[model samples]
Target: MKLKVDYKKCEKAGECYYNHNALFERTDNGFPKILVEDLTTDALRHEAAEAIEVCPTGAITIEE
Candidate 1:
């Protein structure tokens, strides 16, 4: 699976970080920091979907 966060639409609510710190984090400016790109692991796929669901700003998307 492929994952990408739209920084332009992101509100930096930190839901992604709260759920998976190992996969996501917040920058010093409060924006989301995606640790992995183009994830192939099952764990990462689940986590990325979670992040997309939890993102309040609708900034996350998954690509197959």
Candidate 2:
């Protein structure tokens, strides 16, 4: 239910956090960091989906 990131493919574009700051954060190095606990609700999941879609590197995913 949490979000995961594949660092190998991440380019630190800051898109995920930019699209959904409540669920993710931009680290000092520019990588996206998960900020929420669990995406148990539909609204949160939908927001996560939008954030995932904005990832140009396709590095973020749902950790079920």
The numbered model that scores best in lDDT is 2
Q: For candidate 2, list the clashing residue pairs, or say none.
A: none
lDDT of 1 by residue, 19-49 (tens): 8787788889888787887788888888888
lDDT of each: 0.83, 0.88
Q: After superposing candidate 2 on the true structure, give the runs of residues whose Cα lies further than 4 Å from its correct spot.
A: none
Judge candidate 2 against the unseen true structure and give its global Cα lDDT, from 0 to 1.
0.88
- Candidate 2: worst-modelled 10 consecutive residues by lDDT: 31-40
lDDT, model 2, position 63: 81
